[model samples]
Target: MHRARADCTANTSDPVDGQAMHRARADCTANTSDPVDGQAMHRARADCTANTSDPVDGQAMHRARADCTANTSDPVDGQAMHRARADCTANTSDPVDGQAMHRACADCTANTSDPVDGQAMHRARADCTANTSDPVDGHAMHRARADCTANTSDPVDGQAMHRACADCTANTSDPRIVQQCKEIVLLVLLTPVILWVVKPCTGLVLVVLLTPVILWVVKPCTGPVLIVLLTPGIPG
Candidate 1:
């Protein structure tokens, strides 16, 4: 009876040890599964973070490309603007060749006739007519007549003289004829004084002194007068 009791107690102890071993195996499987699942979740999170950062990096690269394009285009636009301004300036200035500008100036000056030379011719003509009967100084009379004819010759010349005379007569209280007469009077007054100062002691001295005086007085009066009188009216 004692041996059978001991055998029964041994069988009960073997069953308890089996249950404890089964429980330990179940706990170990649960622990291993938790660690594996946590590792898988961490890997998924890291992949998601990397994917999100890629888009941001792509956007940054795109912005950098746009900036580079804009920077390169700015200099090209500036160069175009500079070229446009240079073309405008070149068009406005005196031509780079210079000849065109000179020609234009010469054309302008040639078209507008001088007034002072015309007036002098008229005065010489009047002097010639008025002094015609006095001693018949052939050279003096011829010169004066030539000057008068030149100044009064063209219709346009006559008209211009009349207009100038009328304007001068009207604008100021002084008359054109009177001013001219005064100039003649002054010349006459100075003539005697010049002769007295030069005081020719011999015929040769007188001839020398008189020749230049005659030429000086006559040439100024005659050349312009001849030009005025001889030139026909320009065709329209």
Candidate 2:
């Protein structure tokens, strides 16, 4: 009976040991599964972080591209504006130069009493002096008047008087003597026609009678008179 009791005790202890072993095995399996799950979570977190960072990097790149585009366009726009201004300045300068040239030419024309190729020079003078009674045009007229006044005391030849009258009529608008000057010009223009038509026999007789007296007075002065006659008359 003693031996049988001892054997039963031994059997109970063996079952207890087996239970402890089973418990230890279950704990090991749980521990292994925990590490695997932790590793998977770590991988998932890393993948999520990368995904989030990708959009931020893409946005940064987009902003950089926009900045570069704007920076590049600014200089181009500035250059275009500069070119436009330069073109406008050049266009404006040309007209001013042309105007100055015209005025200078007009002044030169008015100062010279000799019949300039007036027709050829008229366009330039007209353009410069057109509507505004510019001081420059007025000054030229004053100079012409002074020249005429200086020469007025010289001997009065009808032909010279006619020429002077014509010059004054064409160049001046002073009303004081304009009508008289015009009449003088008309008389001079008509004189040749009148002389040719009349051919007065009485006038011829008088001219024959005075011819010797006229010749004596004129002979000594002929050289100077011929020179004056040959020289082209100045406008003033």
Candidate 3:
């Protein structure tokens, strides 16, 4: 009779979900998407939130964030978002996590995943970027921002790269680099458009021909980096 009462209490509150949470846990362990496929994800989430007796660990929460990746249809975005939050919260960890997040997302896709999540990334960038008090990441940050703009076609990211690169340029404390970087980024974005308008060989030759003049104008502010950054455009 006592056991029956206990079972009734369990059913009244969580019912089968307390058991199903384990199923979701196993699903994560197996690296499968079953939880995402059904209510198991919801149950797992609710159980993780409410049940102190069976506390979920960081890895579990990490996988829980994978559900966000599934939503974006890109796994790395979710991981970067989760990791950036975890490492950058309270201004505690290194800025590399945040910077890496930006670069990693660029590799697959950028904030084009979701409008709401995109805002979160913006906030995440601000929070993470501010954590490091020094200007050490300036060069890397500049390159990363430029890379962010060059890699993705999203106009939002294009604007974001400008703003973020401005912050990065502050590391060098050179006012001229701002406009220089902007011009370089514009040239980067326009290269493909130019290629489409002309033959690949002609476009390649144009890039080769224009390279000296563009660098001469921008190199003082950009340092010697543009040569390496621009070289990958050559198909052969």
Each candidate's lDDT (Cα)? 0.23, 0.24, 0.34
- Which has the higher TM-score value, candidate number 2 or candidate number 3? 3
1-236: candidate 3 lDDT, tens digit per residue: 11223222122223434432232332222112333323233323322221111111212333344223321212433321222222222211223333323322322232222121122232222223321111443321212233233322222122212233334454433334555677776775476557746787777677667766776655544454465546565564
Q: Could you tally the backbone clashes for each prediction? A: 1, 1, 0
TM-score result, candidate 2? 0.17
- Ranking of predictions according to TM-score: 3, 2, 1
lDDT of 1 at 190: 49
Summarize candidate 2's per-residue lDDT along 1-236 as a digit string, tens digits.
11233222111112222221111111111111112112111111111111110111111111111111111111212211111111111111112222111111212232122132221111112222211111223322222222243222112111111113313534343343445555544543343345435765554444445544543444433454335433532212
**What TM-score number comes out for model 1?**
0.15
The residue-level lDDT of candidate 3 at 53 comes to 11
Q: Relative to the unseen true structure, what is the Cα RMSD of model 3? A: 17.6
Candidate 2 residues lying further than 4 Å off, grouped into runs, are 1-91, 94-138, 141-189, 199-236
| Per-model TM against the reference | 0.15, 0.17, 0.23
In order of lDDT, best first, we have 3, 2, 1
Off by more than 4 A, model 3:
1-177, 221-225, 228-230
lDDT of model 1 at residue 20? 18
